[model samples]
Target chain A: MSAPVIFDPMTLPSDDNVNAYTFCVELKGGEWFLQKGKMIAYYGRIEFNGIGHGRFERLLRTSFHSPLHASDWVVAQGSGKMLLADRAFDVNSYDLEDGNLTIRSGNLLAYQPTLALKQSIVPGFLTLIGTGKFVAASNGPVVFMEPPIRVDPQALVGWADCPSPCHHYDHGYMTGVLGGLRSLTGLGGTSGEEHQFEFVGAGTVLLQSTEMLMAEQATGAVPHEPGVPGGGAGVPGSGHAGQGAAPRLPGQLGDLQRRFGL
Target chain B: MLAVDMSGDSVKAKNGSMVAYDGQMAFKKMSGGGEGLRGMVTRRLTGEQMTVMEVRGQGTCYFADRASEINLVSLHGDKLYVEASNLLCTDAGLRTGTTFTGLRGGATGNGLFTTTVEGMGQAAIMSDGPAVILRVTPQYPLSVDPGAYIAHQGNLQQHFQAGVTFRTLIGEGGGEAFQIRFEGDGLVYVQPSERNTIGGDV
Candidate 1:
């Protein structure tokens, strides 16, 4: 049976533009409570990103520190099935050391092109944050100024001409001491093979928070990889906790990529 | 970063032609005989005032600064247009325009100005998406985000109205209301969502 729609169109903001995209939720085992009334919303000028593919599930909540004027209205909400385009969501993400905000989403298409920054482009302060199970198709060409902003390994937009930061994700253990420290501090440090993606352009970065890889390890849900269709909820997540998280390097990346059809 | 300022100027766009403003104006003649109307609407001018007229076939536009004072027009071309009846100098922006800027405070009623796109380059209006000009027959359906509306298709027009007695508010009136009711058919262009907060978290 079709799930009954509950939204009152007449009740929507009078000035709002809406089409008859009516339908509450249509699923069997799909819990409506987990999905209904949940929508991503914002009151700012956000350009569009591209298409994306992956199992996505995140819960985010942000409240303003003070009563902001109307010029910048406060916003909240989330997404479930994200239809992102190519180049819309970069494979990697960046860490905005300055004014980056945390977010969770079902799909996030940052208008910021997921490409390497140009040699001339200076790495500025604005950032693009996203929180979802993102598996980008492009590794990226992150470009920026001499000393570009430090980018997070997992949270990246794109890259530049020549990429660097190929070092160990940590200075200590392959899976123990370093991994422990990384988790303890949430510091995405580096090592020999670890590379921090860089952007060398006049672009903004989108950001979000996710433990999709870790969540999968704990919940046994595999995410749908790019080339691989369906099921972003069964694989053993990367960075599994101590004895439980997915294994370290040597074979982990390959195994995950294979299952994800990368 | 999108903020709707209620304050702005109601400079003149003589039906069609498009032109720019340089803090100065030159008002021409105005009989103000809007087809359905019975008489010529009279007007008065202030310190800074002028009139403009876009002759029928001359496809061009004119402009004026945010504080330029203006009034009704004589049918230079397609005269009656827009979602509301008023468009003018008002002050309703995020930051009141100081000496550097001028915002005629208050919201202009919704409606369409027949000026060329250039005439509207600096003009902001609410629409469904890329505005679709319609023939306004009784058959076609016309709908739009009250916020994206510029004008409707007929003499039957509606602009920004205050109060929830006519609408339901989630928190409070967005200050932007819903459905600028238009009985006949017309056109509207608007972004995918009037309340779209996509890339950044507002």
Candidate 2:
């Protein structure tokens, strides 16, 4: 067998991937926001501080806007090259130039402090705006597709510059009584692809090669105020009105009861 | 997966790890890792147990365990310190023993002792993903997350570094509050993925 390549601090790649599952970020008196417990190893002198540290109050005000996610993020400072990875998943870095991208919170590994990170209005997702590089991990290699596409929810990693991202259910398949019965009970074979996240307008949609999602990170609880989606009050006059009642079973018609005007 | 080619010789491997063989081979269970009574008692006492099997044959044998990625480490007299679970296979000529690792092993949740491999031979280790081999020099020491550390070789001194402070008590601790600092001349193997170590959360 050929000798395995040994990496020294000088040979380690800067702001690039050492392998498919690992990314090396070089910090030279700069800072990077990293998710908790994602760092594997590092070289040189580097210090990791929790986001709530007093010294980062000013930095947090400008680059971090998600108060709920404060506990999940930390800041790495000093001069060194650090490796980032998550559960052996395929990790890749994306460069954003004055652009905005919304991604699942758990998929994000680390990002340059130049980009502002805020909790997405979509609940479990987070949004990054401005310019800089961010690293994300997916179950498989990410595939980029154009908008006007409907993607499996589990397969979707995120979307960039997309104007509208709405849920799309096969209206024709779930209209009548028979259709509703099939979807509600999985009787007569449900296609399992009845619902998808539809993206329109112009932008790039990122999808993993597989449909398995990474474990979701807790984004903390949003305020229980009105006019806020997932704000604990539930959607007003929507199918979620009964969500507070003991949780619904998978094949139950809990939400579909609203469709029947019951 | 690791394929070992032998010509009427023998190689010691993790027990029950052999998946396939292309030629004739005889497998024998090595009680106490074939290290005799003293090694067995030491391993049992240290909690660094290794159930090894010796495979002797004139053909090629394949070994695998739990679908983990296998990495090859060549030893030319220096000692290799690895977790018991990460060791896959080693040449029959090498001597395997147990050593006390102190706080570093406890922090990584691998007990307070580790397995050591010595002699001139090639050994195969396993990791959750491909392991990155890093060379540590005296000038530039390396600090690795305890959960990601798999193994190390050469003359290196490791210290369990904890950055816990008043902030850590308030739940605002740096996620990487605990690390294993390796200094000296050696090669450290770190997996791309981290195991759930006892000190992972802080």
lDDT score for residue A120 of model 2: 92
What TM-score, computed on C-alpha atoms, does each candidate reach? Answer: 0.28, 0.96
Candidate 2 chain A: worst-modelled 10 consecutive residues by lDDT: A242-251
Model 2: per-residue Cα lDDT over A1-262, one tens digit each: 7889999999999999999999999999999999999999999899999999999999999999999999999999999999998999999999999999999999999999999999898889999999999999999899999989999999999999965899888885657767777877678998889889999998999999998889999988778776566676566777555556254533357546656778
Docking class of 2: high
- DockQ computed for model 2 against the true two-chain complex using alpha carbons: 0.89
Angstrom error at residue A182, model 1: 47
Best by TM-score: 2
List the candidate 1 regions with Cα displacement exceeding 4 Å.
A1-71, A74-128, A131-262, B1-38, B42-80, B83-148, B154-179, B189-202
Candidate lDDT values, in order: 0.26, 0.92
Identify the CAPRI category of the predicted complex in candidate 1.
incorrect
- How much is the lDDT of residue A70 in candidate 2? 93
Clashing pairs counted in every model:
107, 0
